[model samples]
Target: MPLSSLPAPTSSRRVLITGAASGLGLALARGLAERGDRVLATDVARARPDSVPAGVDYLPLDVRLDADWTSALAHVRDSWGGVDVLVNNAGVATGGRIDVATMDEWHRIVDINLLGVVRGCRTFTPLLKEQGRGHIVNVASLAGLVHAPGMASYNAVKAGVVAVSETLDHELAPHGIAVSVVCPAFFRTNLGASFAGADGDMEAAGKRLLERSRRSADEVAAIVISGIDARRDIILTDWDGRIAWRVKRFARPIYRLAMRRAGARIASTSHTIE
Candidate 1:
């Protein structure tokens, strides 16, 4: 189904968001709630984190657990009757060259960043299918669309999200479920604090990029909400992401050159974390 033909988002929606304790997830929860949506904000922490906006329901959800997913589904069913949206936004961050990143690190990131989203979709998709009208929003990153050097694990998992989201968009269209994959550039968020890669230089570089980001979590969340409302299949939340995607698609040679330059820079400065 063409996006134009899909139903527009109603004023009040029942939105379930994972990783809502802080950063982008928190911002998203607040944004949706402020708009009068019934928001179920969840996080992995045993106790609810401070600063979650008032009037939003809180739940403890570690996206990696099947039990948690099941419980979240049950909670929504009991409270809201059914969910209008599922935001698979719980993820951790890591960055290292493939040679430097350990198999254990790769496994951990993939389990959380990629499989976490998978679990959410797998658990909630049946409910969406039953309702025959809903949405799935997966939070990816600019790295998903533009693979940068020294971020093999992060890029791979985020790209997996983008791919899974795309596949679901087509597969679920007939079921009246729209899918949106958000590809936002680095923004001011706690994502960097979760970084646990093997390369010190890569980690430093990533932190620097994040520190320089002009947009805050709330700003990016607002753009993402707009994209969801518009029912966009791919939501590039910033001009940087938008331009990068276009360059890769329409100006391949330039994109390749830029990537090569970035790789060379990383290669020159790369060093293992002690």
Candidate 2:
């Protein structure tokens, strides 16, 4: 379907969001449901989260598990006939310099952050193909595009999400499936709780950034919904992200210098316990 074929804003599309127990995922679920969309809000927890908004359905879905995806698909088919939108929002947070980060850390982040989105896309693309009209939204981060220091694993995986979303936008356009990748800069969320890195200071630094952010998850979720309605292929949800991306694209010299300085500062500050 063409971008113009997307359902109208007033239409109540069936939407499914992963990691809906908390953070941006929870906010998306709430916003979409309040807008009258039939929402299935899923998380890794087996029991329904009390934080889930009223009238929204709940399911247990660990994106890293194949069986969970199968079950989610079954539920969607049985309950909603089929999905009109899929939001792959589940991910973990990790940060470390190349040498400081362990292979296990790299593998775990890739499995949960990058491949998790990949699995969601693979699982639902066939249904969207048959329907010939649907949307897939992947939640990435500014780190995906604006690579800074001490977050190599996170940057790589988020960049992967952006790449995969772009590829699918083209590949699925012929099949009438719209794909969007959302890259929001840091915001106030419990994402810091999920932080896993070789250096404790890296996690501390990430938390500080999150604490300092002006944007909230709810605000970002609203932006994402608007972007999806507009059928945007790349949605940058904040000014910081937009500015950073523009600088990287249009002012390479400045961006490079900034990154070098950030890297040097991090290298000087980062400390790992033996």
Candidate 3:
């Protein structure tokens, strides 16, 4: 369906977004607020912006905590009557080979990146069902579709996200709740800064990668909003991501060869342990 033909934002278009303090989450909140939707933005940090647009509200939330999700959803239910959208945009990244990475690091990454999405979906799916009509947008990544060395855990978690979201889309479609998984290539965000590391070199490498493929957060936000508007099941944020998906699907040998070449580069890095 065309974006123009999608459901228009009315007072009833209530949206709740996680990780709204910065990056794509903030951009999405601002865009949706500008479009006249009542937006409830939440982040784990206490120092959220003091003011948002008149229709936008801010809440404190830690996606890993069940209590936080419950409180956030209850607040939305009471204030907006029902939530029309839920954006599970909160995530963190960890880079290293699975074998070399510390178990603690692996747990932390999975807690925030994979299980966070799982928790969000588990908590909000019922709320969306209660509303009878709603959209769930889960932000995965281009990495979810293909393996990248040094990002073994990250890629695994994102792959799980894609699987869970696709399943949800099938399960929720009959109830008028549309689930869309967004696969975005690198974007200009503070995600690199948020990378947890026990050493300096790993952190530096993460920063370099973040800077390399940076795109404006607003651009990604626009794609997400447009996807929601059009009720698209899969939203690819960049041309590279689209191309990668096509190659992976129709040109398996070529895709595998490309992955092998990319993996060699990543493996050669002293910073990345195989």
Candidate 4:
């Protein structure tokens, strides 16, 4: 089917989001539902009715498990016929340098952040193909594009998401499926809960991230929705992210130098960590 023949994704779309119990995912679920989109919000925990939008459906989903995704997709298929938008927004953050980071930590982070997105895309893509049109949005971080100290695993996985989304956008665009990757700076979210390793270090890093947050989850949610509506393949949340992206692209040596200095400063004396 041609793009011209596909249904317009407006208020009528069936939207599904991962990690919807709190933070950005919860905000997205509520934002979409409030705007009249049929929204299904899923996470490992059930969302409080007070937090979820009036008309939204909540589910328990462990994004690392394919079976969990299967059950959610089944529900959407049975109830709404098919989903028009899929959000791979579940992820974990582990704060440590490579020397301090453990293999177990790496595996856990990769399983949820990178492979999690891959699994979600692999599972629902066929349905999008069958339906002729749909959109997939993967939530990454500014860490992906900008390499920083003490976030080795996070940087790797999020970079993978950006790379994967770019490839998917081109490959699936021909099939009428739009793919986008959203890279946002630090935000006030529950990401701290997913931090791994030393509790003290993690707590410090988590607090720093929260303190650096320039926007709220609800604010990010609105930008995300607008990005998807525009079919933007690469979505940066703030002007700071935009500036860094440009510097990284146009002045590689300078960006690398800054990152190197940053890495050294954090390892040596800085209090904040990404």
Worst 10 residues of 1 by lDDT: 1-10
Q: What TM-score quantifies how close candidate 4 is to the native fold?
A: 0.91
> In candidate 3, residue 41 scores what lDDT?
91
Per-residue lDDT tens digits for candidate 2, residues 124-207, read 998998899999999988888999988889999999999999999999999989999999999999999998667787888889
Over the full model, what C-alpha lDDT does candidate 2 score relative to the true structure? 0.89
Model 3, 1-274: lDDT tens digits are: 2223334464547889998888888888888877777889999976567544456788988988999989987898788777888999999877775556778877887898788898988888898887788899998998888766667778888998899899999999998999999889887888987777553445667678678865788878887888888889888989988998899999999998988997777567665432
Off by over 4 Å in 3: 1-12, 50-55, 198-203, 271-274
TM-scores for the candidates: 0.95, 0.96, 0.90, 0.91
Better-scoring candidate (lDDT), 2 or 4: 2
lDDT of 1 by residue, 132-164 (tens): 899999999999999987788999999999999
- Residue 196's lDDT in candidate 1: 80
lDDT of 3 at 210: 73
* Higher-lDDT candidate of 1 and 4: 1
Model 1 clash pairs are none
CA-lDDT, candidates in order:
0.89, 0.89, 0.81, 0.83
- Residue 45 lDDT in candidate 3: 77
Residue pairs with backbone overlap in model 3: none
